[model samples]
Target: MSTSPSRVFAARLSGLPVFDPAGDQVGKIRDIVVVLRPGGLPPRVLGLVVEVFGRRSIFLPMTRVTHVDSGQVITTGVVNMRRFEQRPTETLVFGQMLDRQVTVRGTGVVGSVYDVAMEPERSRDWVISRVALQEGSKRFGRKGQTHVVEWRDVEGFAAPDGVQGATHLLAALDEMRPADLANVIHDLPPKRRAEIAAALDDERLADVLEELPEEDQVEILGALDNERAADVLEEMSPDDAADLIAELPPETAEKLLQLMDPEEAEDVRRLMSYEEHTAGGMMTTEPVILPPDATVADALAHVRNVELSPSLAALVYVVRPPLEPPTGRLLGVAHIQRLLREPPSTMVGHVLDSDIEPLRATSSLEDCARHLATYNLVAAPVVDDDGRLVGAVTVDDLLDHLLPENWRDTPGRPANPVRIGGTNPGGSRG
Candidate 1:
């Protein structure tokens, strides 16, 4: 069996040089990747989030990494060079873990987790085993001391400590996957949940809000002022944002809609007209589409430019002429694999797989699922009467309807109930 990767405080590697085999300095360590684990064990390090050539950030998988020491990181000399876009399962140390407070397991509130300590494991990878913390003096103007604590030694991240629980909870919660955090929040007391919601940044809050029950959604959205609430909604996926808006008191919903970015609000409003369970309702307004006359290189470039997720990017939809933001008419579809197999000059229209019929906006979830299953496709396009490609119903979103309503809340679930926060742990630098 292979041995697991060694432990290192995230801070220790910050700004460290990444050397390629030939001894060339490739990039500096910008952050570490951590995946929050279930079972209360410390989160394991997945790899390093590195910044290259002074500007772009890309993920360096642990396997590609050869060595990590006090002041340097060594890699296998190869790098993918694709820019890093954080996955739901991953956390970037510097971007998300610093300047926060957390409860030390055996210690009292050891504020702001100033740094994280991680262990590398393969894909079933990641565990945060140590943390650096900062503590301020009671004197209003004094700076806090920083210290290190083992992940196992920190108290739970989210149980209410009455008064400071909300604050401590905020710190620890940053480390959680959005879905898991939402589950934790759903199970918490209403008031406690609201406190956490109010403290969350719009991006993080919007993610959690998407996973929650409507009532919880309403309550949390209520906790924010109209402006903030609208901001959060704007950050959310248009379909989910629209669904939540539909549940709000009409006046509240309208006010928020007005406050949203006009273009984004228009997208959500268009979705609002569809039934929640229909194809249109579950579809995301944004799908990478290209003109039928475009070449394989064009399709590939479009998907890459949009930075679609692995699942969504698997296939690029090809549409007829008016191929602007929302493509005009559905010409057909082309799998990403097909695009790659051909010469760059190959026309996307020539490679089309027109065997499947598009799903109507009113198609039922069952029909959508069947279509995806039959074709072995991850997503099916949704079209309006004019045959314009309005959106797509991804398999993940479709599964939501197929699964039991409270599937996420079941006992012993990998992610049982939501609560996310964590500060860099350590008053002492590594």
Candidate 2:
């Protein structure tokens, strides 16, 4: 039987893999170029600029796309070096997607968005996405045969900063996993990552922190506010959080810790005491939690408002409110969709299944994986000896441990991962 249009498109694109019509491997796509009305409107793909030889870029029109699969983008032909375009004035590929936001449609309503990715080969040409949105990718918890929309399907581009058309894409962009983020960051030069770190807003920074490496977390933290830093740290894996804190100079760390809530700071301090890379060292103090009596509405509210981990609300731990001590006891797990469905007044305990599964702070990656496999869970709660929820580990977090160093090189990762430091290196204004 013939595949439906969507499947055909997805099949042709998902498994096809992207290649430069110009045949230049270095000129990997930075951003998928789209034609947009100067004013706000849906954008359409015009072409793609793949980084060819170092700093040299080649443009591939939408026609160049042969297929896109969950793993790669296949092109009709190799890009010729002669066809490569010169680098643009900007230093980063993401610079091309700046101030712009576009949508990708799934079966019906908008599915997600086309966020930024980096093209290091052509440093000047930052934008390059011949196709948008990959399905069956865990980066965003996407499943099924990955589908990709060509730039042609996109609406108009958002205007650059300060313009009315600048779309607010924080939610869509932040939905990716930390490993995905790390892949994006790895594609860019370390300096560029640090620079981008300094330029990102608090929300963006927090989003990035969940996915960055230990080295990057420190470098970026130095550029953010004590409060912002604290906020990001609060949501991070305890080990990851403590690692960033330990990176801070003694006085600086102490001062920032002082600015943080005593409870939060104390938790971090305890994690800090553990050796880095160990389970106790790497676990997080913060995880999704709901009072055993909390209603689905209440859990939903926390997911939307409280901001646990960036792009992670897969697992919500149901815990009893402390009577003896404020230990976050484990009760049940609530999926985001589940939490959104039931009435706001639905008590968590009543809705919650008693078959609760939990992980320990001292568990190894192998152990974590075993729990995930046993429960078929997207996220598993990490608890202390008393069964108090200290943090929760999402499938994404565990996946990060298994991925190769350069996740971007593999297909299904975010296309635009790098965030360049703009003209203003010291500020996070953009």
Point out where model 1 deviates above 4 Å.
Answer: 1-143, 147-175, 305-307, 324-326, 411-430
Q: List clash counts for every candidate, in order.
A: 44, 55
Candidate 1 C-alpha lDDT tens digits along 1-430: 0332476666667667787777777776766766666667776566776556523456676666677776777776666555555665664455445544567665576677566767654554546777777786788978678777777777544332333324445554456667656755664456667767877889989989988878889999998899999999999988889888998989999999999999999999988988888998888887778877788988888778543556678778888766543567898889988898999999988999888899999999999988999989998788888888888888988987777766543322111111112242111111
Question: Over the stretch 141-169, how does candidate 2's per-residue lDDT look in tens digits?
Answer: 54424334555455534423322111212
Highest TM-score against the true fold, candidate: 1
TM-score of each: 0.59, 0.51
Top lDDT hit: 1
lDDT for 366 (candidate 1): 91
Residue 134 C-alpha lDDT in model 2:
28
